[model samples]
Target: MATNQEEVKLFGVVGSAFVHGVQIALKLKGIEYEFVEEDLANKSDLLLKFNPVYKKVPVFVHNEKPISESNVILEYIDETWKQNPILPSDPYQKALVRFWSKFIQDKIVASFSKAVRAFNDEKEREKNIAEASEALKILENELKEKFFGGEEIGCVDIAAVFVAFTIPLIQEVAGFEFFTAGKFPKLYKWSKEFLNHSIVKEIVPAREPTLVYFKARYELLVSASK
Candidate 1:
């Protein structure tokens, strides 16, 4: 990776797991780049031009060619840098990694988000709790080693970073016991190690402000439900 010739920049918002994934990848690869924070409330012209289809945050621009979607950006970074390889070299293992990564996005995130918002509705809360628990159990079984991709924090770990980062906040706001160690031991242990990772610790936002924001959002959702 030639640093001097190429210009690298990241467009993202704070408190977004998707953006965090890209940032973490950049740090893992030891890639020096500029970060442009986008205000989602007021969509930026540059963000729109780069990601017109989704009109969303987390657009990774490498030499003025922007890559949309966090997973795509992760793949690009791994392929381009070739230093701290995130994905596995073996074809079958790589496929499995992608499967688990997509599973985190598709199966886990929806239920987790629902569980957070269901704080106001007892029945809905329980339903999402059960769903989330089941999903987490599957992940627990998959993480036979230290991380999703063995001992090293790899691409699958990057995909599931939200679980390590935001789940505790949701647990606090919902007053739920979903992520208890007594329940999902492996998943809980993985989360602790994931958060404790040197590079990962650097990217997490301060808990106080994150709590303030999530608390307000929880109250708003509760009120709207009523």
Candidate 2:
């Protein structure tokens, strides 16, 4: 439980998967924190002050200290709250988890974003899709249990919030299909299981509005690409 002396708050925008990861971590640790929804078009001075380097949302402020980046915040939350441990206690297992989490962040998420952004160019989109699918295949081969964290949802699972939720929504809006069940059964199944988890169910943004928002962005991106 969080003490009254320790103040916690999250600065973020709605419909952001990165921000959602932080929310899930805090909830998993049963820490009560204030959520400050930032208007990215006109970012708040507080958010700017907290995360000047990146100037991004999902700036986690704890005890008047701010931690930027979603993955970093998740690690901080796990280290700060002893209960409901997300990272493994063993050093080797912990390193494996961190390795996979970084893989998801760097390869999986980046490849998917490239695919979405390459929507207007068929050849480019196909190339990006191939790269994205290849990344998913690596994760598919790595899964031997219910999650990347084995039996429980761990840091790697939380790190893959974009994979379970956001990427599917992006696929829908972008009219693409790279992460299908037939293509990557293990990863696809893991996504379904991850999304169905109780905490994930609560934290995931409502599908309808999220879709609407992404659809609008998709249109704008396509138009710009043209």
Candidate 3:
């Protein structure tokens, strides 16, 4: 697809959080791009060639340059296209946004991955649950007054939306629930508001379907473990 300026392509899958992050960033920036869905179970040569190190999805190819890692691609998108800027212009605010963005990518995304599926050690699972809760609590507190950084849905908010959605799927698979009303009120409210937005609602897949998919996979994994 032409952006009336240059061709942009994003390689990723719909169910992936990282991929969703980049997609939302691009949409919010009003950037046009072609989205290529990869079958991660059967990765294509192009994906391997583009991201040899991580061989992960959510790789953004801009002007023939391949950028991997969702957060890195987000930064690249902000810098490359100055329209509808996601990060704050102020240095301190930018730092805060980046910090929470990294926190979500690390604690919520990476750490929760292990916590949900293929958890062999009971102790390890407990540790992961604790850590994940800590991260969620921090996010909840940060989102107490506003919808993320301020009144708008910015970089950190974008990341949080995916985290809130996918994390529940992870929790359901692991027989856990973190977004209880009493426990994470702010985050729960934010999640509701974020998912309700026209942009997010239009782009995202239905929650029940995602839950069913993950539950089946989780059941299979649990059976295999036993």
Candidate 4:
């Protein structure tokens, strides 16, 4: 299929938080791409073919070359498009962005488990909360300025926004709130501004639908635990 610009096809569900990162990055770069929604529960043959290792969503296939992992896809989108760039030109600055992105991904695992499963032990619950808090603190410091790096919405800003937006909904489902603005004032402010961005606003899923998604995931998680 010929695209107005060279065709770029992205495979993932709209509500997948990682997919949202790619969607926002592509929009920011003003890239024209076709979105193919995948049924994660069903495990599409295309996804399995493209990413055999993880077999996950948020797969970016550019002219048939497949790229998995959201952060990798973000980098690929920015580098390929070269229009509204996502990463900084400086090396040190770029490293800073990667640092936060990795941090967010790491904490996300623990947070997801905490959000989905029932914690019978107070010790385990405390451990999960501590892990989440540590991650949020790093974000708070990174967003001390108006942006993750400065006045503009850069790669780090976009990467962290996925966590900020999704974390609240996860908290809602878990019946716990770990992201207190009081504890992480800078991150809170940055999240408010990032979510308020016109591009961000356009792509953000409605809260109700997000909550429903979380509830469904939580149920599956609970069942898996049993």
Model number with the top lDDT:
2
Q: Which sequence of candidate numbers ranks them by TM-score, best first? A: 2, 1, 3, 4
Error of 3 at 61 (Å): 0.7
Clashing pairs in 4: none
TM-score for predicted model 3 compared with the true structure? 0.91
Whole-model lDDT per candidate: 0.86, 0.88, 0.80, 0.78
lDDT of 4 by residue, 172-205 (tens): 8777777767888777777888888889888878
List candidate 3 segments past 4 Å from native: 118-120, 223-226
Cα lDDT of model 2 by residue, 1-226, tens digit: 8898989999998889889988988888899999999999899999999999999989999998999988889888999999999999999998888888889888889878887887557888788788878888888898899988788888988988898889889998888777788988888899999988899889888889999998997898789878
Alpha-carbon runs more than 4 Å astray in model 1 = 224-226
Write model 1 residue lDDT over 129-183, tens digit each, in one string: 7887888899889888898878889999999888888888868876877787899
lDDT order of candidates, top first: 2, 1, 3, 4
Alpha carbon lDDT at 31, candidate 4? 73
Worst 10 residues of 4 by lDDT: 109-118
The lDDT, on a scale of 0 to 1, for candidate 4 is 0.78
> Candidate 1 has what TM-score?
0.93
Q: Deviation in angstroms for 183 in model 1?
A: 1.1
How many Å off is the CA of 221 in candidate 4? 2.3
Give the number of colliding residue pairs in candidate 4. Answer: 0
